[model samples]
Target: MADRPTGDTSLPPRAAEFLELRPLLFAIAYRVLGRVTEAEDVVQDTWLHYQDVTERPRSPKAYLSTVVTRLSINVLSSARVRREEYIGEWFPEPLLEDPYQEPERAAELADSVSTAALVLMERLSPLERAAFVLREVFGFDYAAIADTLGRSQSACRQLVVRARRHMARGRARFAADRRAQQELAARFFAAIADGDVDQLRDLLAADVQLVTDTGGNAPAPPRPIVGVENTVRVLASVLPELGRVGLRLEPQPINGEPGALARDREGNLVQAITLETGEGRIRTIRSVSNPDKLTHLGPVADPWQLARDYRESRRRQR
Candidate 1:
């Protein structure tokens, strides 16, 4: 156990303890709930409850972890209902920033937070997901996990086993090298920008699938666009329009994986496009266009920038 910090004179001891455990608390909340804003809210609620504690526990970190876990479970339960009524195939809000504190465990951290892992977790029961994250991702002992989840140690272990079995099928099956993945993503968008359908097909698997969430504000296939040929055709079909509107794709990391951030000519962000590759080819491409979800991404691209740039380019062409 790490040493608890001495609180500021103006602050309560419990408040100071929360600040010390905040990073881990937020990590637990975010991974459990899969929403940044919601996770922050959960942490805030935990602080409110902790500050009012008349009796401080012997282990502040453990106490705080328990509080966050319970709150997150409650949040996830209600959120599942709302997700069922969401406008389209919902995707977890992209975690543009990596928030893991342990540099030595960065790779492990990245694996846990990858879009695929987060998506697969949706299939898990709230208790199952909480058990896996606390034990597998955060290295909590089975006893600690049991205490946090209010389950028996044996039950906590069973939950983790069950969650792993459910997630094992979708775990990364391709190269784990980030550099290689980044190069592949760069080539993918380059091919898209050049309208090279053959190149796109070569980079995709036979069953390649694309899922886009525009939240009904922009045009997107209502259902997942699947299959190599069909996916290529749909993507290629958009190139002419993209060129006409001066929309360009730049390789950027999204949710810790190599991806493309679409921007207009003026460099405002339009979309966050992430790729999940396996067996040496692209398997899933996720493009999130929900404006409400992109607030943390900074400087949204003007919707009309494409047309404005097209007009300017045409003017110069003359």
Candidate 2:
């Protein structure tokens, strides 16, 4: 038996064991589900079950991972329904910074949790997503992955192969250079804040696409805006309003990519924007203005209020 708690929430032996592996379990769940809240829930639930076990497992790491992955699979099953009803284009919740402890697998880990990768994973079934994350990203062997998913080793291998085929087109092609990403992001946001259309256009890919998620709670384009010209026009028009409301831009690492967090005059987060760059030009931009998503990041202001204020200010100017 584990030690009793002095308080109601004191750590038990199994709970302590699970807590030690919390980072790894979180990485697995987040990779599988792409939502922080859901991922955290899965980890917590795994700990709850871990406490009930009368027999100790030979390897707690594998046991906890299995529990987390299965729980995430269950969540993902229902999450897909909500996603289908989601307003506008839905994106994975941005991981503001790396939270896991495996520095050696940093590159691999980043690719697994990247905005593009998560979006691509949405096309895969929950089981395939689990198999891919376990086998490819976390380096789990076929037999272990099979046990985790309650499938045969051969079947798990097939799931990984199928997932790879589905993701081949969208898989990452660039090496992550944190310094380069930060420098480019700095220049990119500076151009936006300064309203330098030409500079912004220069930093963008010829066929860049911008996707914004406001969940119909705030004003945003109803669909993805594609093409360099369209994206530049849209950014030029919206960013000024953002700036007008005294929303400041700060560079931060989001989902392993250099990105910007937008805050209002009072320092409340209004939006988070992440860019994908290649050949020194931005190819993709994802922004989340959904208040529900921003709550976990920090205190968030109403995005629509800012837009409304921008309109009123512009009217007064006229």
Candidate 3:
């Protein structure tokens, strides 16, 4: 991931323009590509390429969005192949913080970068995803989206329509009450800490789904766990193990929704979880412990090693 610039207030006029739009550029790239590192790479590439344009554009935002969108589409093209060969269900890397949080369109922006929404986006063609993100997420009109994708305005509209249709097929009707989500999450975390199966079961919908992506050998099933009973069993089983392993989970906003982050005793991030709630119940739980995904948050402990340590601790107790 490109390191965000620090301690540099003395940028050239053009560079300053790029810096001002960096957040939007990164947001566009991330929402399209669904990967922080690749999005950051696109942002850096946009900056480098933008520096070479001697004549300033009439509109910097449009130009920057166009460049970053194209670069992200290119990255997503190659990324598709690896995703097909991935061992388990591939999830977009968890995003802890959104760089492009637009207050006026806050809910739309939040839902667009959401884990569930991003997962559905993976099914879309790169252009379709880009078009949808530009139009739906960022409020870009067809003309602007057309410029970004190098297509006619009508064609851009078509892409958005198709992408929206594809996404709607799998989209859940999530409750939009932020405060309700927070309150539920607080209770759910309390249940997890206590390993209270009944409360956990109560908080989850009857058909709640838990999808975990470790991306390697950690403590997660390769297949998804579905239903309240099955989810409760898995969650209850793992909750105690976390204590044994000296890992702690804290409720945090992840991807603009109520979620949790796990850390080891030494404060190294180990896992991230995003909760999707609806009708006052947790419907989907996304757990991503992938080391490659967690590195951006900071020092990522080796989950594989953590497993070994847990086993050793078990042996010592015996």
The best-first sequence of candidates by lDDT reads 3, 2, 1
What are the C-alpha RMSDs, in order, of all predicted structures? 4.6, 2.7, 2.0
**Tens-digit lDDT track of model 3 for 1-318:** 434444378866787888889889999999988888888888999988787799999999999999999999999999999888776777777788887767888888898888989999999999999999988888888888888889999888899999999999999866589889889899999999998989998999988999988766467786899999999998887678768888899889998889999999999988899899999999999988888887878998888888888778767777
lDDT of 1 by residue, 1-318 (tens): 223334566665666778878889988898998888898889888887786688998999888999999999999998998877788867777787766578888878888888888889999999999999998899999999988888999999899999999999767666687777777787888898788888899999898999988767556667998999989988887655666676778787877888877877677778888999876688899998776667667777654445455557667656
Q: How many steric clashes between backbone atoms does each model show?
A: 0, 0, 0
Q: Against the true structure, candidate 1 has what lDDT?
A: 0.82
lDDT of 3 at 311: 75
- Top-scoring candidate (lDDT): 3
lDDT for each residue of candidate 2 in 175-221, tens digit (9 for 90 to 100): 66767777888899889878999999999989899989888877788
Model 2, C-alpha of 98: deviation from truth (Å) = 3.0
In candidate 1, position 56 carries an lDDT of 90
Of 1 and 3, the candidate ranking higher by lDDT:
3
Estimate the TM-score of every prediction.
0.85, 0.93, 0.95
Q: lDDT at 257 for candidate 1?
A: 84
lDDT to native, each model? 0.82, 0.86, 0.87
